[model samples]
Target: MNYLRGEFDLCTGCEACLLVCSNRAAGGYNPRLARLKVFRENENLINRPLVCTQCENPFCMHSCPVSAISRAEKTGVVLIDKEKCISCGSCIKACPDQMIRWDKTGKADKCDLCAGNPLCVQYCVPGALKLVKKREVPGK
Candidate 1:
Protein backbone atom coordinates (compact mmCIF):
# COMPACT_ATOMS: atom_id res chain seq x y z
CA MET A 1 0.00 0.00 0.00
CA ASN A 2 1.19 3.45 -0.86
CA TYR A 3 0.87 6.43 1.43
CA LEU A 4 1.80 10.07 1.38
CA ARG A 5 5.45 10.65 2.08
CA GLY A 6 5.85 14.40 2.19
CA GLU A 7 9.26 15.93 1.54
CA PHE A 8 9.74 19.16 3.44
CA ASP A 9 12.79 19.98 1.40
CA LEU A 10 10.65 20.19 -1.71
CA CYS A 11 7.61 21.70 -0.07
CA THR A 12 6.89 25.35 -0.79
CA GLY A 13 4.03 25.69 1.70
CA CYS A 14 1.72 26.38 -1.20
CA GLU A 15 -1.27 24.90 0.64
CA ALA A 16 -2.72 23.60 -2.59
CA CYS A 17 -2.77 20.10 -1.16
CA LEU A 18 -4.64 21.35 1.86
CA LEU A 19 -7.24 23.07 -0.28
CA VAL A 20 -7.91 20.03 -2.42
CA CYS A 21 -7.88 17.62 0.46
CA SER A 22 -10.16 19.80 2.53
CA ASN A 23 -12.59 20.14 -0.32
CA ARG A 24 -12.78 16.43 -0.91
CA ALA A 25 -12.84 15.50 2.74
CA ALA A 26 -15.11 18.22 4.05
CA GLY A 27 -16.95 19.46 0.97
CA GLY A 28 -15.64 22.96 1.58
CA TYR A 29 -12.51 25.11 1.31
CA ASN A 30 -11.09 25.00 4.77
CA PRO A 31 -7.56 23.90 5.60
CA ARG A 32 -8.50 23.09 9.16
CA LEU A 33 -11.01 20.62 7.82
CA ALA A 34 -8.48 18.96 5.55
CA ARG A 35 -7.26 15.53 6.52
CA LEU A 36 -3.71 16.63 5.77
CA LYS A 37 -2.25 19.73 7.33
CA VAL A 38 0.82 21.84 6.62
CA PHE A 39 2.74 23.61 9.31
CA ARG A 40 5.16 26.43 8.74
CA GLU A 41 8.10 26.76 11.04
CA ASN A 42 11.14 28.98 11.51
CA GLU A 43 9.53 31.96 9.83
CA ASN A 44 8.42 29.74 6.97
CA LEU A 45 11.90 28.32 6.35
CA ILE A 46 10.36 24.87 6.53
CA ASN A 47 6.95 23.66 5.46
CA ARG A 48 5.90 20.41 7.05
CA PRO A 49 3.06 18.43 5.59
CA LEU A 50 1.38 16.45 8.32
CA VAL A 51 -0.52 13.35 7.22
CA CYS A 52 -1.58 9.91 8.45
CA THR A 53 1.15 7.25 8.23
CA GLN A 54 -1.24 4.28 8.47
CA CYS A 55 1.02 2.68 11.01
CA GLU A 56 0.93 -1.05 11.47
CA ASN A 57 0.15 -0.38 15.12
CA PRO A 58 -2.20 2.50 14.60
CA PHE A 59 -3.26 4.04 17.84
CA CYS A 60 -6.35 5.57 16.27
CA MET A 61 -7.71 2.19 15.30
CA HIS A 62 -7.16 0.79 18.73
CA SER A 63 -8.43 3.86 20.50
CA CYS A 64 -11.72 3.97 18.69
CA PRO A 65 -14.10 2.32 21.11
CA VAL A 66 -16.67 1.78 18.39
CA SER A 67 -14.15 0.41 15.91
CA ALA A 68 -15.10 3.14 13.51
CA ILE A 69 -11.59 3.31 12.18
CA SER A 70 -9.99 0.44 10.33
CA ARG A 71 -7.37 -0.35 7.73
CA ALA A 72 -8.33 -1.11 4.16
CA GLU A 73 -7.40 -4.66 3.15
CA LYS A 74 -6.72 -3.85 -0.47
CA THR A 75 -4.65 -0.70 0.03
CA GLY A 76 -3.64 -0.79 3.66
CA VAL A 77 -5.09 2.66 4.03
CA VAL A 78 -6.62 3.66 7.31
CA LEU A 79 -10.23 4.77 6.98
CA ILE A 80 -12.89 6.08 9.31
CA ASP A 81 -16.48 4.97 9.22
CA LYS A 82 -18.30 8.24 9.83
CA GLU A 83 -21.48 6.44 10.68
CA LYS A 84 -19.87 4.54 13.50
CA CYS A 85 -17.92 7.46 14.87
CA ILE A 86 -19.32 8.86 18.06
CA SER A 87 -17.29 12.08 18.19
CA CYS A 88 -15.57 10.80 21.30
CA GLY A 89 -12.15 12.11 20.17
CA SER A 90 -10.26 9.09 21.45
CA CYS A 91 -8.67 8.55 18.07
CA ILE A 92 -7.68 12.21 17.91
CA LYS A 93 -5.67 11.87 21.08
CA ALA A 94 -4.22 8.53 20.01
CA CYS A 95 -2.81 9.77 16.74
CA PRO A 96 0.89 10.42 17.28
CA ASP A 97 1.25 12.57 14.17
CA GLN A 98 -1.67 14.84 15.18
CA MET A 99 -2.89 14.40 11.61
CA ILE A 100 -6.41 13.60 12.65
CA ARG A 101 -8.74 16.54 13.13
CA TRP A 102 -12.35 17.01 14.11
CA ASP A 103 -14.64 17.90 11.28
CA LYS A 104 -17.61 20.23 11.42
CA THR A 105 -19.76 17.26 12.25
CA GLY A 106 -17.32 16.47 15.09
CA LYS A 107 -16.14 13.17 13.61
CA ALA A 108 -12.45 12.37 13.44
CA ASP A 109 -10.93 12.83 10.00
CA LYS A 110 -7.65 11.56 8.58
CA CYS A 111 -6.08 10.70 5.29
CA ASP A 112 -7.60 7.76 3.41
CA LEU A 113 -5.04 7.63 0.57
CA CYS A 114 -7.86 9.06 -1.56
CA ALA A 115 -9.18 5.52 -2.07
CA GLY A 116 -6.14 4.89 -4.32
CA ASN A 117 -4.83 8.12 -5.89
CA PRO A 118 -4.24 11.05 -3.56
CA LEU A 119 -5.38 14.52 -4.52
CA CYS A 120 -2.58 16.03 -2.49
CA VAL A 121 0.05 14.35 -4.66
CA GLN A 122 -1.84 15.31 -7.78
CA TYR A 123 -2.00 18.99 -6.81
CA CYS A 124 1.39 19.36 -5.18
CA VAL A 125 3.14 21.51 -7.78
CA PRO A 126 6.48 21.27 -6.04
CA GLY A 127 6.23 17.47 -5.96
CA ALA A 128 6.70 17.57 -2.24
CA LEU A 129 3.98 15.01 -1.51
CA LYS A 130 4.23 11.49 -2.97
CA LEU A 131 2.27 8.26 -2.74
CA VAL A 132 5.02 5.72 -2.38
CA LYS A 133 5.23 2.09 -1.35
CA LYS A 134 5.96 1.42 2.28
CA ARG A 135 9.70 0.80 2.49
CA GLU A 136 12.20 0.33 5.26
CA VAL A 137 14.40 3.20 4.08
CA PRO A 138 11.66 5.40 2.55
CA GLY A 139 13.44 5.37 -0.83
CA LYS A 140 15.19 2.04 -0.84
Candidate 2:
Protein backbone atom coordinates (compact mmCIF):
# COMPACT_ATOMS: atom_id res chain seq x y z
CA MET A 1 0.00 0.00 0.00
CA ASN A 2 1.06 3.57 -0.66
CA TYR A 3 -0.01 6.78 1.05
CA LEU A 4 0.70 10.50 1.16
CA ARG A 5 3.22 11.81 3.68
CA GLY A 6 3.55 15.41 4.78
CA GLU A 7 6.47 17.24 6.35
CA PHE A 8 5.65 20.51 8.04
CA ASP A 9 9.29 21.49 8.28
CA LEU A 10 9.55 21.45 4.50
CA CYS A 11 6.27 23.20 3.77
CA THR A 12 6.20 26.80 2.50
CA GLY A 13 2.39 27.14 2.51
CA CYS A 14 2.42 28.06 -1.14
CA GLU A 15 -0.75 26.00 -1.61
CA ALA A 16 0.38 24.82 -5.04
CA CYS A 17 -0.61 21.31 -4.14
CA LEU A 18 -4.09 22.47 -3.20
CA LEU A 19 -4.53 24.35 -6.46
CA VAL A 20 -3.53 21.43 -8.61
CA CYS A 21 -5.52 18.94 -6.57
CA SER A 22 -8.59 21.13 -6.68
CA ASN A 23 -8.34 21.46 -10.43
CA ARG A 24 -8.07 17.74 -10.94
CA ALA A 25 -10.57 16.63 -8.33
CA ALA A 26 -13.18 19.35 -8.45
CA GLY A 27 -12.64 20.84 -11.90
CA GLY A 28 -11.74 24.15 -10.32
CA TYR A 29 -8.72 26.08 -9.04
CA ASN A 30 -10.20 26.78 -5.62
CA PRO A 31 -8.06 25.58 -2.76
CA ARG A 32 -11.13 25.07 -0.56
CA LEU A 33 -12.21 22.26 -2.86
CA ALA A 34 -8.97 20.35 -2.57
CA ARG A 35 -9.12 16.91 -0.99
CA LEU A 36 -6.14 17.74 1.23
CA LYS A 37 -5.50 20.76 3.41
CA VAL A 38 -2.58 22.73 4.79
CA PHE A 39 -2.65 24.04 8.32
CA ARG A 40 -0.60 26.81 9.84
CA GLU A 41 0.61 27.12 13.39
CA ASN A 42 2.71 29.29 15.68
CA GLU A 43 1.64 32.53 14.08
CA ASN A 44 1.92 30.98 10.63
CA LEU A 45 5.51 30.00 11.20
CA ILE A 46 4.69 26.34 10.63
CA ASN A 47 2.76 25.12 7.62
CA ARG A 48 1.70 21.51 7.68
CA PRO A 49 0.09 19.64 4.85
CA LEU A 50 -2.65 17.21 5.83
CA VAL A 51 -3.70 14.42 3.50
CA CYS A 52 -5.46 11.12 3.67
CA THR A 53 -3.15 8.37 4.94
CA GLN A 54 -5.42 5.61 3.58
CA CYS A 55 -5.53 3.89 6.90
CA GLU A 56 -5.36 0.10 7.18
CA ASN A 57 -8.55 0.30 9.20
CA PRO A 58 -10.27 3.33 7.71
CA PHE A 59 -13.08 4.76 9.82
CA CYS A 60 -14.48 6.53 6.80
CA MET A 61 -15.16 3.21 5.11
CA HIS A 62 -16.66 1.58 8.17
CA SER A 63 -18.88 4.53 9.03
CA CYS A 64 -20.59 4.70 5.68
CA PRO A 65 -24.16 3.54 6.24
CA VAL A 66 -24.60 2.69 2.57
CA SER A 67 -21.18 1.12 2.19
CA ALA A 68 -20.21 3.84 -0.28
CA ILE A 69 -16.66 4.02 0.99
CA SER A 70 -14.31 1.10 0.40
CA ARG A 71 -10.63 0.40 0.25
CA ALA A 72 -9.43 -0.70 -3.13
CA GLU A 73 -7.83 -4.13 -2.92
CA LYS A 74 -5.06 -3.38 -5.40
CA THR A 75 -4.07 0.10 -4.21
CA GLY A 76 -5.38 0.28 -0.68
CA VAL A 77 -6.85 3.66 -1.53
CA VAL A 78 -10.07 4.47 0.27
CA LEU A 79 -12.56 5.54 -2.34
CA ILE A 80 -16.08 6.95 -2.10
CA ASP A 81 -18.64 5.50 -4.46
CA LYS A 82 -20.84 8.48 -5.22
CA GLU A 83 -23.44 6.28 -6.82
CA LYS A 84 -24.07 4.44 -3.59
CA CYS A 85 -23.56 7.39 -1.28
CA ILE A 86 -26.48 8.89 0.62
CA SER A 87 -24.60 11.99 1.88
CA CYS A 88 -25.44 11.15 5.47
CA GLY A 89 -22.18 12.73 6.70
CA SER A 90 -21.32 9.64 8.69
CA CYS A 91 -17.93 9.23 7.08
CA ILE A 92 -17.15 12.90 7.58
CA LYS A 93 -17.88 12.66 11.26
CA ALA A 94 -15.94 9.44 11.63
CA CYS A 95 -12.77 10.81 10.06
CA PRO A 96 -10.56 12.10 12.83
CA ASP A 97 -8.35 13.89 10.32
CA GLN A 98 -11.37 15.53 8.68
CA MET A 99 -10.28 14.29 5.27
CA ILE A 100 -13.68 13.32 3.91
CA ARG A 101 -15.88 16.17 2.64
CA TRP A 102 -18.93 17.03 0.60
CA ASP A 103 -18.28 17.92 -2.98
CA LYS A 104 -20.31 20.30 -5.14
CA THR A 105 -22.69 17.51 -6.02
CA GLY A 106 -23.36 17.00 -2.29
CA LYS A 107 -21.58 13.64 -2.36
CA ALA A 108 -18.82 12.49 -0.06
CA ASP A 109 -15.31 13.10 -1.38
CA LYS A 110 -11.81 12.23 -0.31
CA CYS A 111 -8.41 11.47 -1.68
CA ASP A 112 -7.99 8.38 -3.84
CA LEU A 113 -4.31 9.06 -4.52
CA CYS A 114 -5.51 10.36 -7.87
CA ALA A 115 -5.66 6.72 -8.92
CA GLY A 116 -2.02 6.25 -7.87
CA ASN A 117 -0.73 9.45 -9.44
CA PRO A 118 -1.41 12.20 -6.98
CA LEU A 119 -1.36 15.71 -8.42
CA CYS A 120 -0.79 17.18 -4.95
CA VAL A 121 2.50 15.30 -4.62
CA GLN A 122 3.50 16.42 -8.08
CA TYR A 123 2.69 20.08 -7.47
CA CYS A 124 4.23 20.23 -4.02
CA VAL A 125 7.37 22.11 -5.03
CA PRO A 126 8.72 22.18 -1.47
CA GLY A 127 8.60 18.36 -1.35
CA ALA A 128 6.40 18.52 1.73
CA LEU A 129 4.01 16.00 0.24
CA LYS A 130 5.10 12.60 -1.04
CA LEU A 131 3.45 9.41 -2.19
CA VAL A 132 5.38 6.85 -0.23
CA LYS A 133 5.13 3.08 -0.32
CA LYS A 134 4.19 1.63 3.05
CA ARG A 135 7.24 -0.64 3.15
CA GLU A 136 9.58 2.26 2.47
CA VAL A 137 8.28 4.30 5.39
CA PRO A 138 10.40 4.27 8.53
CA GLY A 139 8.87 3.12 11.83
CA LYS A 140 5.86 1.73 10.09
- Where's the lowest-lDDT run of ten residues in candidate 1? 131-140
Off by over 4 Å in 1: 135-140
Checking candidate 1 for backbone clashes, the offending pairs are none
Query: Which stretches of model 2 miss by more than 4 angstroms?
Result: 135-140
Worst 10 residues of 2 by lDDT: 131-140
lDDT of each: 0.85, 0.88
Question: lDDT by residue for model 1 over 83-133, one digit each (tens)?
Answer: 999999999898878888887788888888888888999999999998888
Tens-place lDDT per residue, model 2, 41-116, is: 9999999889999987788888888889887777777899999999999999999989988898999999989888
C-alpha RMSD of candidate 1: 3.6
What's the C-alpha lDDT at position 39 in model 1?
Answer: 91
Q: TM-scores of the models, in the given order? A: 0.91, 0.94
